[model samples]
Target: MSIKSKPTLQDVARMAGVSSMTVSRALTKPDIVSEQTRQKIDHAVRELGYVPNLAASQLVTRRSGIVGALITTITNPILATTIETLQQGLARAGFHMLIGETRFSQEEEGKLLRAFLGRQLDGLILAYGYHSPETLELLQAAEIPVIELWDLPEGEVPRQPVGQVVGFSNWAAGASAGRHLVACGYRKPAFFGYDDERENLRFQGFRRAVLDGLGVEPQRYKTSAIPSIEDGVDMIERLARGELDCDAAFFTNDMQAIGALFACQRLGIAVPQTLGICGFGDLPIARVAAPSLTSVRIPAEKVANSTVELLCQRIKGEEPWAANIDVGSELVARESTALRR
Candidate 1:
């Protein structure tokens, strides 16, 4: 047969001697179709050089083959890495990523959720903290699967989860980090954290695990916005100048903890001897920051792998997934929080 315009599914069906519905099933749900017919359709597609229109298919299937993702910020290395791995995971399953930034804003997150809903996405991945009521409504009304990236404290929220959760507890990670510093012989420790909800939860864990139970109080400093190394440097300088009181400090993240290391160097103080420091996230910077900072190693890779697998499983309509799938974290001892310190 001579073809003029771009070949369509109709051409493939006619050439293969099958109906359009059979062609559709062969392409989408091949398991139910017979092998001989599937091979015939495959050969006809190759012979006719047919390119299926994904947009047209989506119009009928109501699935864009796109997964919506909302993250706090791309600048932060942790979330950046998470998004990267998430995309790779989705791509393996023939899905593309449609990403948005919330900048830790509930309103912006709600807008993104609504926009994604409008786009007819196949599913959603939220690496964010808070959600608006409108966003919740969108999720409840959505037929696709929804996953919250952060681990919600089992019973603290006083509400059921919006969807499946595939993450670890920030509080538990923070508490373990605090305990690491204390067990290393550091007393009068301080904590540096941001004003974000997740960071605040970590702070609570640190306080309960290190302060109340250990009989040591931290010189606390909580600031708004994303924490940076400068925040760590600035806080340590104040502590060095006797304006703050703490021989050691625990940071909500590695960026701040690494900052404290730089500040200690500037203040002519020795690490592990004069000051003990611990950070969360166990980011790569933690490993090369001179003394190699101690940190809570969040299983980000495992989290990514599991998140993708779990989301795909649900997308395939798999049932009986646990309410919360915890990919827990671990504490690493390093020179920064040496036992001799």
Candidate 2:
């Protein structure tokens, strides 16, 4: 039951009938070794299951071979999917991910940023909006490639920069959502959201579209400081109590929509009959829910891929276009808001 020992460079060198230095050169600097010798070293390494020590190699290269990811929360499904995609894509490019969650707190984000700065991270990926000026300054001074996702800043991109960013326009996506809801015949639609700045942008877009396109002013919608399943349930309960009134509702994210759906079921409110529900982020659970959720697909994987690509380019001293880039979102309709028969 003892664990087997890891095969070392000496084992491969012995099997290949070559010096350890020669085997190392064949594995790392293949150009310095003959093709025949390289092939022999490769075969020996494969037979012995000898893997290169990345940490040791990184010491000489002065690169950590690791990427730091700062996220608002770990429990968010959409963010989880995006991070998963990013990790997979980064791994393919010979990089590992070091994750830190801030729970959507600026103070926590600053602390995490400082901690990661001490590490040997080659790059940084932020999942939420940049709000901390100190953290931004540190990132700029570090000169490492930094990519921001999910949320984009409202004002002009700062001149003192870190690296490239790949994200979608949250305001535009919200406006699109508003248009879709209005086109689908929702007049008295309400927005259910969190107090985050990005969510505020979406709310503003929704308001603008409803006022301009629909020519109707939406009533005050139910919102919470923290958008979670429990908050969703509380909002629905209040609605049942006649505190809120709406024929259709737009949730900040799919998690809240799922919560609202469950609450509707518990209250015996016929979905898309007595009320309609829509959410942002086309999470997997959205499809599995009863009367599948109608939501906006955020292109999480594509954003992750593009972010890593841009970061790599920046790391290589390649000048990319703009620091900020926006990808578009798509509206996916499902039974939650299906047309009435």
Candidate 3:
């Protein structure tokens, strides 16, 4: 099929019986054009399904009005909430969001970074933490504001980022889960989650916490792919059948923790009594899970608020009050790790 040519300002002008300048004025500054002219242009635009050229507006303003975001996935609630809030804040500040999926890989992010730079993004927000050497060079060369979200890289939770970081300590979040389990009197514990760059950071933190708090390192059961409910359930079944030697477990997130609950029910493994489970992210379901999951809470909205503030400062060529901000985290004690139960 032959493709129809895109309707331009000239085409709209022709249909409305006006000059291109008149059509532009009607679309942008309607008050400068007569009501009759605007009505004619509007009718023409609707009939032709003409869309406004946002690129032209960007060129004139020297601001792309496009903020590029690289997130692992929209399926995960933590990243999804932060991305949605970031978009809303950017929109309020007269910017649009263009998102790229990275799936927590530096390689995937590197490709998306190149594409975003080609698109002339005004800023970038990243959910994934790792950056390849080439990706770092590209970002440094681009000289645009980049906000790294989610977690700090290489146990640099307290280190101020060179660009800007709007995240908490992934290690610390995981550590809290481990420490809480130890406090609940669990002698043996396991760590089950995705084996990725950031998840490794969590694993490290959890191990340190478990070793220090209970003098025992957690048994690691990891997947190279993204951790899902199915992975959690299957891992739990294995543990239930005496496959993994651990009495309690801390998962990377609540989905897996809840799945473990199902496995326990199926295998008649008593939670807290025989097995204690803790999770990260403190998702809503954690509170309502069969035994109420113990989890670490990251403040998504609070992080978004800080991210937008930093972006706005950078956009206006002003230094932020602080280059890196730790939004902080909390541990939600729940029935799953109850000491009395």
lDDT to native, each model = 0.81, 0.80, 0.81
Per-residue accuracy of model 3 over 99-190 as CA lDDT, tens digit each: 99877677888899899999888888877667788988898899998888877645645434447888887888878888888888888878
Name the runs in model 1 displaced over 4 angstroms: 1-52, 155-159
Residue-level lDDT of model 2, residues 1-341, one tens digit each, is: 99999999998989999999998766555557887888899899889888899779778877777889998888888888888999987875657799999888888888998899888788999887656788877877888888888775553442332455677767777777777677777777888887667777888888888788678877556565455777677778888999998878889788888899999999998888777888889999899999899998888888988888888777667887566777778888998886644
Ranking by TM-score: 2, 1, 3
> Each candidate's TM vs. the true structure?
0.83, 0.84, 0.82
| Model 3, runs deviating above 4 Å | 1-50, 153-162
* Model 2 ranges with Cα > 4 A deviation: 1-7, 12-56, 155-162, 220-226, 321-323
Better of 1 and 3 by lDDT: 3
Winning candidate number (TM-score): 2
For model 1 the TM-score comes to 0.83
TM-score result, candidate 2: 0.84
By TM-score, the better pick of 1 and 2 is: 2
Q: Mind giving the per-residue lDDT tens digits that candidate 1 earns over 1-341?
A: 99789888999999999999999878755667898999999999999998777788888876778899988777777777788899888876767899998877888898888888888888899886467788787788887888888666443663356778888887888788778777777777777887766777777788877765478666678744665778888888888788887777888778888888998988888998988888878899899889999988887777777788888788888873566788888998888989962
Worst 10 residues of 3 by lDDT: 153-162
